[model samples]
Target chain A: MALTASDVTIHFGGVVAVNGMALDVMPGEIVGLIGPNGAGKTTFINCLSGTYRPNTGTALWQGDELIGLSPSALLRKGVARTFQNVASLHDLTVLDIAKLGAGVRRDRRTGGHLLDFFRSDRALEELLMESILAPLELNDVAHKPIQTLSYGRRKAVDLARALAGDPQLLLLDEPVAGLTSHEGMAMAAAVRDVRDRHGCAVIMVEHKMDVVMSTCDRVAVMAAGSKIFEGRPAEVQADPEVRRVYLGEP
Target chain B: MSTRHIAIAIGVAVVMAVLAVVLGRYGAYLVNAVAIAAIGALSLNLLIGYCGQISFAQGALLGVGAYTAGNLGNAGLDGAVAILGAGVLGALVSALIGLPAMRLRGLYFAIATLAAQAILEYLFKILDPLTNGVSGLVIKPPSIFGIPMTSDESLVLPSLVLLVIAWLVVSRLLRTDLGRAFLVVRESEIVAKGMGIDVGHTKLWAFLIGGFIAGMAGALIGFANRLASPEAFTLDLSADYIAMIIIGGLGTWPGPIIGAAFVVLLPEVIQRVGEAAGISDILSALRELAFGLLIILFLIFEPRGLTALLSRIKLRRIGVVPPAGLRATGEGSQSPEGRSR
Candidate 1:
């Protein structure tokens, strides 16, 4: 397993946010976490991303303990996440944010210089623009500041920032939320391409059923802070329990 | 980058030099004060404008540098050495202060910096022998490259040169990747951290750079006055520094210069108005009161400072109507195209 979570539990005061959640992500596969509102889907991603510390159990990346690490530390461990509410970076261009992601993977000594002297080593930035951003058809607005982009484009930039880290495992929170239908499919295609090109594990928390069905290799269903089922995307669709919990089927 | 900018800069420099020469001793004194204050104001602008950190301790850092220079000068050190020592000492102390406190945010950090200013001022007062207590220390005129600058006209040339150097350094630094990192930290720590930026370290660096500028300014002021007194580095001085940055435009290079000129000239204008009204003292008091009120007003309405306001006006004149897209959020947003559009 490239990433694994065993009996992870987190509580806010007396209320349980994530309870005894266990998940395993194999290398080079995209896993989907699907749930209703307040189902603790984002909460699980938060624990994995080190935004929230789990009260019990372990989160491991390649058998190294991943719980309680800072976001930057986790980034060093080759894990990265995108935010649902995107950050506002007013002074930088699109390339700047991309460079920031690349900067995370870079050693402090090499990248700390006032200028990017080793720009050749940072081919990932160019690759990201062409492969991920361009295929998402964000080329026309690639030079714009993130704030000037539409909500759909901003979310794409967020994904691009995550990709810049060259992460071994990527955690995405609502990657297609707020996007137009055309943009949503384009983003979904980009996610697939990122996995195809990078061979990285992906754990996505998404509300878009069409995206999950089409993009994810395996689907994990959650309801009220606990995973009810885990199987292939087709099996997940066939499972009556998942259908009842998430789709309101009998 | 533009011919107009170059022309304006050159014109201003010539006018300032001529003013120093043509205007008598009193005018030279005011010009010197403005030049020194502009250096300090620019330093604060780095923190206040670019880094989005408000500091009230710039004047205190300036005081520290001035005292260091004065003491070193009294010990029979050469002018250049004394001035250099003052700046180095001030930067060291400010960097030390930043190391622990840069982790904080908002009003909490501001309060910590203010407290630092208060404590430093007290230290200056308590160290009577070194700082000469509240009595202050008298310094001799500084000599640069065998040229004696004892008189106001002689001092003006050096002051203007230092001001230009300060402006150039600040301008150049803001265009680099390090400058972009400072802005990244200022915008959101979470985003910065996510991008693998050492947010704490970046904040500390900003504080250090700002302090270095303030320290250099302090050295210049000390040389101009040939004295170091506790009264020279008071809370009032700190407030004046804050006022200069706020009025000028905060983050832009020209903001501090304009702010320094306004604050320095406003008092003279008020004195004249006060003389005409036969309430000179009250008029001066009102100016001080107005200075404080202006800070509050800027915070409420135009926190981006005069530069942003002017840019908007210019845009309007060019027949460009800005969309009401992101202005509702107050803070400026960068477009995906990378401009601050």
Candidate 2:
């Protein structure tokens, strides 16, 4: 398995945000985690990605401990994630954001200061630019600062940045939560395309049923922070417990 | 970056040197004072402009350096060693201040630095043995490499040379990895950390660098005056350094120089007008009032500074259409690609 979380739980004061959540994602697999609003899908992702410390249980990536690491530590260990809120995201071009992701890898071995002369070199930057942006069809606007782009284009840019890190596993927190149906399908196909090209594992946290059902190879359903169902997307669609928790008294 | 840029810089230096020779003593004194201020202002720019740390301790550090230099000079340490000793003292004091104040942010950071200034001034008052306190200390002028530079015209040459050295340090830093990290930290500490930047260490380095430059400037200023006084390193002087960076444009290579020239020359020009009109005190007050108003106006309307405005005008003049993202606002848009994700 590329990544596994066994019996993970998190608490905020007295409230249990995530309770006994178990998940596994294999290499090149696109696994979906879905639930209704406030069901703690993001909290689970945060626990796995080192944004929050799990109160109990273990998170492992290829048998290495994934819990208790800082976000940068996780990033250096070959895991990088994009935030849902995306704070401090001003004035940077598409390439610049991608360069930040590229910066993560550079800082891993060489201290950032020493890498200045080579990091932003034209040839290497162009290569990274092509690999990350061309897949998202963002090559045309690569030089343009992200602020000028449409919401859809900006989302594409964010994805490109994550891809720039050359991550072994991508934990996408609702990659297309508010996108139009066309954009959603494009994003889903792009996710699949990235997996195919890079052979990276994916764990998608999403609420869109159409996206989860169509794109996910395997689906896990959450109800009140615990994994209530896990199987093929078709099994998840028919699970009575998932329906009762998400779709209301079935 | 290119050979052509270096050539042009050398050409400018030659012209400035010729101008100093023609203008004589009074002009040299003006140039010397301005050069020292520029060095101090540029150092502060690294912290305030590039690293986004708002500090008002430049003047206090300057005072520390001057006192150190004055004391050292009196003890027969002489020229270069005395100046170097002063810089070391400034760095040590600055590091001590940064250790606690680094934990504070925003208004708290400002207050902490202000308190540092107050404490330093108090020390200067209470410690009469070392500092001479209220009476201050007067010393002989420096003779560099056994060459006596008694006249203002001769002093200007060395001061200009120091300014050039300060400029080189700033240029080298802006192009280095450490420099880019400084910019990154200023832009977003969170993002910088994610990219494996040690934010605390970076800020400390900034404080040290700024202190070192301010220290050097202080030594020069004290040497020029042939005296070290507590009043010379007041909060107003710190505010003036901040003003220089703001007017020049923060985070740009040329901005600090532009800012230094304006702040240094403004009072002189005002004094000249006052002399012609036979009204000295009113002219001085008018200059102070003008400086205060400019600070307020720039902070409100053109916070990105003179460099940003100049860039916009340059772009318009060149008829190079701004990128769609850059067109909406001069500061760039909020959270752009990162926010959407």
Candidate 3:
């Protein structure tokens, strides 16, 4: 398994945000986490990404415990995440943000750090333009500051940033939450493409049913901070309790 | 740098050199003042503009450099050794001040720096054996080989050389990964940490680099004035250095130089105008008032400083469109909005 998180539990005041959340994903597989609002899907992703420390948990990535590492530490360990709300940076071009992502990659080319003092970033710029920005269809506005882009384009930039690192385990929080249907479909396709190319495990917390159904190799359902069901997408849709609580079937 | 940037730099250098040779003694003195101020302003800009750390201890730090150089020079050390020694001391003192920066930010961080200034200033007076207290110490003219650099004309070249070195160091550093990390920390520490940068360490580096430059500026000042006095570095001097960077344009490489020249030359220009109009008394009384008003006007009308204003003019002349999302108001464009999720 690429990631095996078990008995992950966290509490905020008296409320248990996530309790006994257990998940396992094989290499190159995409796991869709689907649930109602406040079901701890994002909370679980946050725990795995090191944004929140679960009070009790065993989150092992490739056999290493990821309980107390910082976000940057996790990133260096080949784990990266995208925010639900994309951050709009002033004075920084889309390409610049992508470069920042590429800058932290563990396998960055030799002398990239040292050469930055005396050399232009043209080579890395070209590489990122072709590999990351072009795939996201953000090449046209790559030189423009991120704040100038449309909301959908900004969301794409966020995804591009995460992908630039070529992470082993990608955690996405509502990657398609506010995008149009076309954008959402494109984003889901990109996630699949990333999985195929990098052979990385992905745990995507999303509310879009069609996206989850089409993109995920497996599905997990959560309600009130605990996993209620785990199965194939079709099986998840057919589960009686998932149908009653999440799919709204009588 | 591109060919165009190189050409511009060379052109500026040639103009300054010619001005130094042709201008009378007073002009050379003024140029030296501009150069010294530029060094301090540039260092302060690194902390305030790029790293987003407000430091009010620059004046005290300058005093530290000046006293170190002056006392060492009086003790028969080579001028180069004194200046370098001062720089090393400045970096150490700045790192000490930066310890508190890890726990404070914004106004609180600024207050801590202010306290550092107060403590250092008091130490300068109490450590009378080293600093010579309120009486101050006389500085010997720094010599290169056997030639003494005594006159303003001679000092102008050294001052200009120091300024160029300061500019080159800062500009080069800004292009490096460490510089980019500084910008990230300034924009958002959370994002910086997320990207694997140690925010505290970056801030400390900023302080160290800034203090080193400030120390170099102090050594230059001691060389120019032939004295290292406590009165020369006061809270007001620190405020002026801050004003120079703000009025020039923060974060832009040329901003400090431009701002320093403006701050240094304005008073001399006012004095000249007063003498010519036979109203020296009135103008002397209003000098401080005029300085305050100018800063206010610039802040209100051109908050990005002269650098942004110049760029806007250049863009207009070239008929190029400004970046689309830039806000209409000058002050709004400078705000750190949309920096965080």
Candidate 4:
């Protein structure tokens, strides 16, 4: 298995946001996590990404404990994530963000970034431009500042940034939440393509049921902070308890 | 930066060197003052403008350089070596001042820097043996190689050369991965962390590099005046540099040089204009008032500074709508809103 996270629990003051959540994903498998608002779908992903520390749990990635590492440390270990909202305050070009992603992925054990002074970055820039930006359709506006782009394109840029590092475990939070259907479909296809090319494990937390059903290899349902149902997409849709809790059926 | 940018820098250096040689004594002195101020402003811009770490201890930091160079020169070291020693010490001291910045940010980090300035100023007054107390230390006119640079005309060359070096170094840094990391840290540290950038490390580098340049400028000031005094480096001096960078264009590369010249020359121009207007009797009193008023007006009408205003005018020449109020956040910047700078 690529990832095995079990018995994860967290609380914010008096509220338990995620309670005893467990999940496992094999290499190259795509796992979809879906639930209603305030159901801790994002909270659980946050735990895995090192944005928050769960009170008690163990997340083993290839037998390494992954709970306490920083987000940057996790990136060094081949883990990366995409945010739900791409901040528009940054005025950098799409290529700039891609370069930043690629920069952190380099094994800087010898001299750190000090040797970056002597190194020419032409090859890295060209590689990111061709391999990373081209596939996501971001090559057209690769030089434009991200603040000038439309919302959908900015979302694509965020995905491009994550994939720049060639992550082995990709955690995506609401990748298609604010996108139009056309953009959403394109983002879904890109995720599938990434998995095929990299053979990396993916755990996507999203609200769009159709995209989840079509893209995910297996579906996990959560309600009130715990996993309520786990099965294939077809099995998940037919389950009566999932329908009542997730779809508001009486 | 491109090869074209490098070419333009060399061209400017050559032209400025020629002008410094041709100008009279007072003109050389004025050019030296502006060049020194520009170097200091460039350092501040790197911290607050590019790295998003606001500092108010710049004046004390410069004082730290001045005193170090003064002591080194008095000890019989070469002038160039003294200046470089000052830079190394300044970098260490700046990293010390930036320790709080590893935890504080925005207005709070700015306040911590303010406290640091106050403390350093006090130290300069009380460190009698080293600082020569409130009386200041008299610096020997150290030689560059073997030639004594006793006149303003002779000193202008070193000042201009250092200015060019500082400019190119800053420009080159922005193109490197470390420089891009600075911009990301500026936008938001949380975003920086998500991208696997160590926020503390980037901020520390900002302080180190900026402090080193400030130290070099301070050493030049010590050599120029032949003294290092507590009064020469004060809270007001820090405010003057902050004004220079802000009025020039914040993070814009040319902002510091343009702002420095304007700030240094403004009083001289006022004095000349007042004399020309036959108001010599009251001009001295009114000049300071007018200067304060102009700064206030600029902040209100053009917070983005003269760089943005000039660019706007250039764009207007071709019938394009000028985005006049956008602060120079970084390269290719044109944001609708302004930050705390």
Cα lDDT tens digits for candidate 1, A1-250 = 9988989999999989899999999999999999899999999998988888899989888989999887878888899998887877775667767767766665564435445422343465577677656766677776676777788888888888788788889999999988888888988989999999889999999989899999999999989889999999889888888888787664
In model 3, the Cα lDDT at residue A208 comes to 96
The candidate maximizing DockQ is 4
Q: How does model 4 score on DockQ? A: 0.62
Relative to the true structure, candidate 2 reaches a TM of 0.85
Task: Judge the docking of candidate 4 as incorrect, acceptable, medium or high.
Answer: medium
lDDT of 4 by residue, B5-121 (tens): 678667866776777777888878888888889889999989977898889999999999999999999999988998999899889989999999988889998899999999999
User: What Cα-based lDDT does every candidate model obtain?
Assistant: 0.78, 0.76, 0.81, 0.86
User: DockQ, in order, for the candidates?
Assistant: 0.40, 0.31, 0.41, 0.62
lDDT of 4 at B302: 72
Candidate 1 chain A TM-score vs. reference chain A: 0.91
Ranking by lDDT: 4, 3, 1, 2
lDDT for B3 in candidate 3 is 47
Better of 2 and 4 by DockQ: 4
Give the per-residue Cα lDDT of candidate 4 at B199: 87
Estimate TM-scores for all models.
Answer: 0.88, 0.85, 0.91, 0.96
Rank by TM-score, highest first.
Answer: 4, 3, 1, 2
For candidate 3, the clash count comes to: 0
The pairs that clash in candidate 3 are none
Worst 10 residues of 2 chain A by lDDT: A106-115
